[model samples]
Target chain A: MELLSNLALGFGVASSLTNLGFCLIGVLLGTLIGVLPGIGATATIAMLLPITFQLEPVSSLIMLAGIYYGAQYGGSTTAILINMPGESSSAVTAIDGYQMARQGRAGTALATAALGSFFAGSVATFLVALFAPPLTAVALKFGAAEYFSLMVMGLVMSVALAHGSVLKALAMVVLGLLLGMVGTDVYTGAPRFTMGITQFADGLNFVAVAVGVFGIAEILRNLENEHDRQVMTKNISRLFPNRDEFRQMVAPILRGTGIGSVLGILPGGGAILASFASYTVEKKLSKHPEEFGKGALAGVAGPESANNAGAQTSFIPLLTLGIPANPVMALMIGAMIIQGIVPGPNVVSEQPELFWGIIASMWIGNLMLVVLNLPLIGLWVKLLTVPYYVLFPIIMAMCSIGVYSVNSNTYDLFAVAGFGLLGYVLSKLRCEPAPLLLGFVLGPLLEENLRRAMILSRGDPTTFVTRPISATLLVLSLAILVLVFLPQIRKRRDEVFTESDA
Target chain B: MSTKPKDGTDIAAGLLFMAIAGFFAWQGLGLDMGTSTRMGPGYFPMVLSGLLFILGAVILFKAFGRPDDEPMGRIAWRGILFILPAPIFFGLTVRGLGFVPALFVTTLIASQASLRMRPLAALVLSVVVTIMSTLIFSYGLGLPFRRFGPWLPL
Candidate 1:
């Protein structure tokens, strides 16, 4: 009864004319940018983030949530039609989805992706509504020590999930932590790394850093090779799945949704892993496993559903604990902070409408994706043909305006340039930026909790171990570190990443 | 050449990390390094910098004797030259030249990052982008930005 009443309240807020309109705009814009080559959901959201800032908190956050889902759906469209996934999570989709396109089933692949995502999204939204409240209650009881250990676990998980060498990812995390420390000390008024520039006393602008590292670095990478994208737009013959195709998708979609809901709650890149895991599962379970990578309907259905489910449930951690499950969620946390909402258990109790409104909007946004996007596939396919050179300039201009409008600070724009170069260099050196971005977002919180816990314990380092929750979390982090380092596991990890890369 | 093969990318990355660590450490030394319980401004950063240095050193050490090298692919020299400066130019000129002109020039500068973009196309694109941006951000959103700043004779 309480759940139903909460749902009613959420629907009441989300379906208001203004909120619905904002949500629609967010979904449309997110898809537009995400459909373009060389931009992922993270960069699309980062570039479009400032546009949402001008709205009321509820509407802005609702819009942002819409953008996230919409971008992901657009990514699937690109994957199926062009074989070039806009994001890594959608890479698995491209394998079979593109094959399907070539086999003249592009419409079926796209339809499968849309339907699977909607089903998984609906289930995951309900799961979030079901699980988030209880989790928030538990999180409300967390002390500084537990929070500190949890963040440590989150950081370690990010490193574990990151592609390539663990050492590089760890170094990236440390580097990000340092960058996060650049602003004035929170406990004390001392400027830590301002380099005597008074304008930077508040620290590097988050929006600037995000736009530079994700958006600008991405553009530079695309510019490295000027090539035409092969669009498979001509062979889209059918919009709806036949009975046999629908039957084949049903089991995988169910399994993928289940797997994704569980994994999505884990901090540090759960959605990416969820999709990969779903692909692997579907392959192993298929009666004709050989059909995988050869236009298997299950391949397109499973990962799409898993990833959508993962993306939706990833919000649970943020909603309940104020901890982001991935980089995109980190950006959402940043948006919340900009809106003056402290991201934690307090948000649930304090801003019930904002919390529930977002939950309600997720389902609404997913519905819009299925309803509006299927009809608009031709338009997105046309957008795919737009020259890369033309798009980058528009993106750059938007990035500048977005970052500048945030604070009207000239220093922020300069920071964007500097970070863009730094990001490009780091990528060139084969370092993953996701871990770095995660660490940057969590840096201040980690430090604050560590210091507070230490002071509370009267400088006893053992207090972390003494606290049961903290001890368990730290143990999990240690176990993960050891698991990643083991020779056999490391090789297998490399193989998984390589498979996804191909 | 060295007797053993080394991962050049890792080697470069390690050195870069170490250099950054050294810089942070040097800067952090100026701030107070309070006791562990009551950390001053520099304590956490100092620890992170040291950790980074060690990680970098380990990466460097491991790079040697690797079987093969992972080539660092082509760099975006043109993009760096043009794209990186576009924002900095806007930062320097936005107030003086105002939003419309500043955004226009920024778009024009960024369009040159690609070899395929011709000068005439770039100009036309900038005009369209600037107009649309001004209309959307300045007028539609009602952001308090002057179309032309006081420095403009107009």
Candidate 2:
């Protein structure tokens, strides 16, 4: 009965005119950014972070959630149309979807993508509503030791799953942890790395670091390759899928939704993994594996659905446990902090309306994406040709302004510039920024829990292994670390990454 | 054509990480670094620093084994040149020059990063971006910032 009431309340809040309008706006902006190469959902969210400050917390969250999932749907459009993915999750779609487009079946591929995403999104949203409360109930029992161990597991898994060398990822995570400790020490009340600067007392601004790394660094990276992408928008025949195509898509879509929903719950496994896993599974299951890269409708359907579903369900970890599974969720944590809401297990019991409202809005956002994107494909395709030269300047200006607005100070602008350069240099060195951000977000929490657990156990480090839940989590982290380092698994991970590029 | 060094990126990355760890460790040494029962601000940092340094060393050694990593591939020095300065210039000028003027200058500077963009087109793009940003961010969104600097007429 309580669950029913919660769902009813969520629906009521989400149906409000203001929330609905923001949802529409979020998806529209998400799709526009998602249609463009080199500007992804992570960077887009970081740039638009300032706008969330002006709106109500609930509405802002609804809008942000809308942007996150909406990007997944939009990413496939660019992948299918141009053979260039706007986001990593949609990279697989380009393999088959672009070939479909070249054969003058662009409309059919687009339709299949949209319909498959909608179906998966709907099921995943329902799964979220059903599963989130129970997950929160379990997380509520977690103590300091368990929390610390859980954070370790999350960080380790992020290292294990991140692109490039595992050693490099570990270094980035450690670097992030160090960067996070730049502010005043929580226990000692002494400024650790502030160097007597007033702004350093509060810490390096989250908005600054995120925008600099994701937004500015991305702009820098995109501009490095000034060559224009050739977008194929015309020569579309038959928008709707034929009877045979529809029948072929049904099984892949269902299987993808299941895989995505499950994978979305795992630490460091999200939309990208869900899409890649589903595509591989579908390829293996198909009668004609040869058709995979040659305009297979099932290829387009499965991964598209999986990614959308995974994007929706990825919110579960953030909402229920107050932990971010990736960089996008890390930015969400910053947004939540700004809204004066601590992202953790108690959030559901404390603010049921905000939680449920966001959940309900996701379903609505998916519906809006299908309706909005399907007809406006031509418009999105046009936006892609705006030229990066004209676009980068506006983005740069907005990024500085967005960072400045966070504290109404110029110092953070300098911080943004510094981090932008750092991001660029490190990325060039083949280190991914996601794990760093994840580690940065969790750094303070990890330290706090470690400190508290130590105090409780009188400095017995073995307490982490003695406690049941904590021990299991620590073991899982160790196991995953070991597995990632194993030659066979590492080879498979590289193949998975390469296949996405293919 | 010059031959690029193999695993050059990994070697550089490892060294940089180690340098950062050295700084953290040095700073940690300056702090109290209390016992496990009562950790000072520097205790956890020192431990973390040591671990990071060891990890960096491992990464460096590994690069020796995989020295045949895909060559560094085309460096975007043009982007590096224009993109970095654009924000620094804005930060320096925004307070004195106001949002629109600062933004205009920044846009012009950054526009040069793209080889394909002509001057007239860049100018046109700047005007449009300045006006739209002023309207949307300042007026429409009610972001509390001066539209123009004190030197400019209101």
Candidate 3:
């Protein structure tokens, strides 16, 4: 009865005219970006975040959340149709989906992806409603020391999981932390590295930096080779899979949903990992593993479902724990803060409608995507043909407008160049930006929690370890680091990374 | 662990990290780190800087070791040339030339980054983009930006 009442309340809030309108727009825009390869949800969200500042928190969030799912769905469509991924997480879908397209079964591939995603989204939305409250209650019990340790664990795991050398990632994290400390210090009010600029006193503009790093830097990367992309076909042969193919897909979709549901709760690339894991599992379980890269229906179904499920459930951490598992979630946190709502365990207890409403909106968005996409598959394929030339400039213009609108200061616009350069250099060095972003988002919180815990324990250095939860988290981080660095595991991880190439 | 130089690039990155670490450490010291109990603004930074210093040292030490050497990838100067200037021009002119002209100029410049664009085509594209953006962002959405800068002749 409690769950039913909660669902009723959520639906009441989500089904309103404004919420539904924004949700539709969000998903539509999300799909557009997803269909157009090279532009990612993170960059799109960052650019749109400023515009969202004009709307109500719930509407903005409903739209942004829709965008996330829509992008996922859109990315799959591109992958299946043209062998291009709009985002990294959809790489696995492209592997088999493109094969299906080449075989003149593109319609079946698109249908499978959409249906699998709808199923996964429905299940994961239920999972969020089921699990979020309990997780929030657990998070609410955490102390400053525990939270600090958890951030450390999150950072270390991010570093361990990141591609390329561990040292580079760690350095990037420290560098991020240092950069995060640029604003006026809370306790003493003394500025660190502000260099007398009044703007830095408030802290580096997050939108400018995020758009620069993820958006503009990505544009630069795409321009390097600027390879010509060709669309094999513009027409869908059939909209539905044959009964035999549908039956084959059932087990993989279920299995993918299961993997994604569980792993989606973890930090760093859960959706990506889930899709890849499901793909591998499906391949191994297949009687004809050779058919995997050559258009196996299960291949498209499994990863598509897994990624959608993973994307939906990845919201769990941000909603309950206030910790972002990736860059996009970090932007979500930033958006929440801009709305004057602190993100964390207290959000559910205080703003139950927001939580339940977002959950309900996600389901509605998924249903809309299913209905909206199947008939519009041709339109999306046509969208893929838009040259990068026109697209990138429009994107850049939007980025400039978004960054400038934030503080109405041109200073932040200039900051974009600096961050873009840094983002470019780091990516060039093969260093992952996830760790740096995690560090930036978590840095100040980590320092504050550390100070509080130490102060509470009379400045004892052992306080971090003496607290049981903190110690446990620290040990877990240590264990992950050790295991990740093991030669066999490292080699396997590298293989996975290289294969996914996300 | 296999100890051998991975690449010359890592060495360069390592030194960059070290230089940054040393600068932050010096700044922290200048800020006057207080005791652990009643920490000053400098204390947490110093600790972080110290850890960074160690991380940098490790990378530098690893630079003398095992196998995987690859050249640093291309810079995509075409992107750098256009993308950087696009924003700067927008910022400089957005206030003076108004959103329409600034956006028009910025978009036109940025479209040059792609080798496939013709000037006449880009010019037409810029005009459509500017008109649409002015209508959408300024008139429809009611964003308080100017449509035309003072420098533009009416």
Q: Give the top-scoring candidate (TM-score).
A: 1
> What is the C-alpha lDDT profile of model 1 across A1-502, one tens digit per residue?
9999999899999999999999899889878766886877787677667877889999999988888888888889999899888777888899999999999999999999999999999999999999999999999999999999998999999999999999999999999989999989999899988899998999888888888898899899999999999999899878899999999999999999999999989999888889989999999999999999899999999999999999999999999999999999999998999889999999988999999999999999999999999999999999999999999999899999988888899999999999999999999998999999999999999999999999999999999999999999999999999999999999999988887777
Q: Give the TM-score of candidate 3.
A: 0.96
The TM-score values for the models, in the order shown, are 0.99, 0.97, 0.96
- C-alpha RMSD over true interface residues, each candidate: 0.7, 1.4, 1.5
Q: For each candidate, report its DockQ versus the true two-chain complex.
A: 0.90, 0.68, 0.65
lDDT minimum window of 10 residues, candidate 1 chain A: A43-52
Q: Judge candidate 1 at residue B138 and give its lDDT.
A: 96
Better of 1 and 3 by DockQ: 1
Q: Pick the candidate with the highest DockQ.
A: 1
User: What ranges in model 1 sit over 4 Å off?
Assistant: none
The CA root-mean-square deviation of candidate 2, after full C-alpha superposition on the true structure, stands at: 1.9
- Candidate 1, residue B127: the lDDT equals 100
lDDT of 3 by residue, B1-154 (tens): 5454466677677777788889888777668577887778898888888888888888877876545466776779989999878888888889999898899999999889888788998898888888888887788777889888799888
Error of 2 at B129 (Å): 1.0
